[model samples]
Target: MSAVFEAMIRFGLRLAGSQFPVFIFPLLVFIVFRWRAMFSSVRENPAARLLLSYLLVVFVLRFVLYMSGYPYQGRYFHPITILTVFPIAGGLLLIGRYIEKFKRGNLLAWLVLAVVAASAGKVLNPPDPKKWLKDIPDAIRANAPADGRRTELISVVEDRRLPFYAKSGYHLLMPIFGDMFRDAEIFLADGASETGKKLKGKGASPLDLEGRKGGIKLIVRFDEPTKLRAIAFLWSLTPDKMKADVSFQTVEGGDFLKAELVSSNQEGVVFRQELTAKNIIIAIDVKSNSLWHLSTVRGHGFDSYQVFTQGYYNGMMKWLPEEDFKFGLQSVTQAADEWGGDNVFILFDATIPEVEKALEERRLRGKIMPVGEFTTHKGKPLSLYRGIAPDRRD
Candidate 1:
């Protein structure tokens, strides 16, 4: 039932193809019945029954989850490996008895060899741990806070060894799962899933989506009114000159309220407006035929301390929510905060973009520097960056 156990099972199955194991189980069972003395009491044996029951439990749970339209990741197959280990071992031993009784040739020996070869060929290869990430927990722990009890360790890596490995020290939070869905996401602007079907022709830029007339309308609605103290958008424009009009709509709707008109300039990205609202809707009427790449947005609040989103993926690259910049800075400044220490650690192959600018924009004057650097087994370099002190909210 635990995520850790499930991941391991999927890892094992991936190492060995499903076809042979799938066939082996039923065949082994059939062989056992024919030769009743071959662990015939296995069905009655409590240990054998318990493992077998666990296998069925995982199988049904995974089946129900996948059927309900959760992203069909192959990781779900992992737990069955662990749950079936005991049952399979006894079954295999039973099958051995059948093999010895019925066959007198090298057929069984050759089958085992073939299964091993097939497994090695089809097994999935998990990535090697990059130096920065592998060392970060320990490094931060080395310089750990004096009473490091409640600090929640956050990381962008999807590795399963987090909170488990972290049981002794920092309380690790789960990474941002890529395929986690939101009901309100059906309204995201220019997102691939929202427009992919509508964009049937070549020039679909001036097309209409949901209710927006032209261009892209980015809408975000909080169930209750919230003060957005700061927002950092990691965006790029195609044309030399471009501008966007930001707007908002309240729960009581009569007319769309004008918020702030922003344009990219030499002073980093700028927008002058109180972003506090129940609902913030940005209906962009882009000028100069420009294309925009939205990278990240960070909303700072008490309960919503950290929110990072890969806003839109256009078949190639991913974008982010402007979150970690503030938290990354806290990683150092509040390195020794008493309760619920605020620090956000993220993962990247190249580097974290606009980290310095993010701190500057938020008026947290500091430098974004890499902490640990190391190469992966595949010769890839990685490092973790954070806004180091002299950083204070303006």
Candidate 2:
């Protein structure tokens, strides 16, 4: 019932903002005050009756789905919008007639025309892209090094599409997602399960542990002892009453030594430390009989390229390991801290003057060197810059 009410409210706002702009609320009040007259007007028109009936049926169907807990989003509101136009036109006609009876027909007609003009303006000139982020990808590609040396980039700009543009010789690194997890092999206690194998290589798929119970032992082994900067176990759907015991083997054929569990919750577990290990063993027991999913294990180490970005999508697949590349993090920096890199390219929307200001003032130990500039589809500017490392800077 609550969900249905929420959906109705959302749909109402969308309808008013789109179809019935400027007069929906006042028209609604008029209908409430003179419902008999409005009903008589509607009832006399066969076209009005059919249109209203169709709109009502659609609303009822949506209400039913909302009551059943089906998700309601922008796409779901589209059909309702289409069904509403006829009823809105009829309502406007009825209102226009009432106003003419009161000798204000020209005023009411002009108000309706004004609303239509406003809506047309919105359609003709849609909202500009957020800070011209759409052009960052092109800016990065245009400014990339021409000598073909592998270039590692960390974009702090709030753009999700930037990662998809990472191809050819460009490597996009998200510090939050470690680099070593890609090369590690996952094995179940008895052997490699079909689900376990799915999580082995690039673009690893999520693990669905729904409805299963009891202890599950999984081992992640690397080709050699790998230095760990960060290890994160991500969950798409977290289970209830879950606990994980983590241990590491620092040497080949060495005894598994217990590693302190940094943090654990229904969402996932994260261990941040500097350690070298050949195998990581995770023993998990699910006590709740509920649906949950384990997405992927991500890690960063000395072997992987190090870069940080504050603008990655939460839903992006983190299975791809950082390709063997040459880049390093000189220090740990906060999200708000200035971004710095040696020969490292950074792409950001230049429309926000504050972004460039923040970068110059707080960079770890480098100066920004502009490499390329671009104008977005809507004409906002995007910028690409290279950070000159301390040694590289004269």
Best by lDDT: 2
Off by over 4 Å in 1: 1-64, 71-105, 113-133, 142-369, 374-382, 385-394
Cα lDDT computed for each candidate against the true fold: 0.37, 0.42
Deviating ranges (above 4 Å) for candidate 2:
1-20, 26-76, 104-111, 134-171, 176-319, 323-344, 348-384, 387-394
Alpha carbon deviation, residue 379, candidate 1 (Å):
10
Per-residue lDDT of candidate 1, residues 236-261 (tens digit): 11122324443333232233211122
TM-score (all chains, Cα) for each model: 0.36, 0.43
lDDT of 1: 0.37
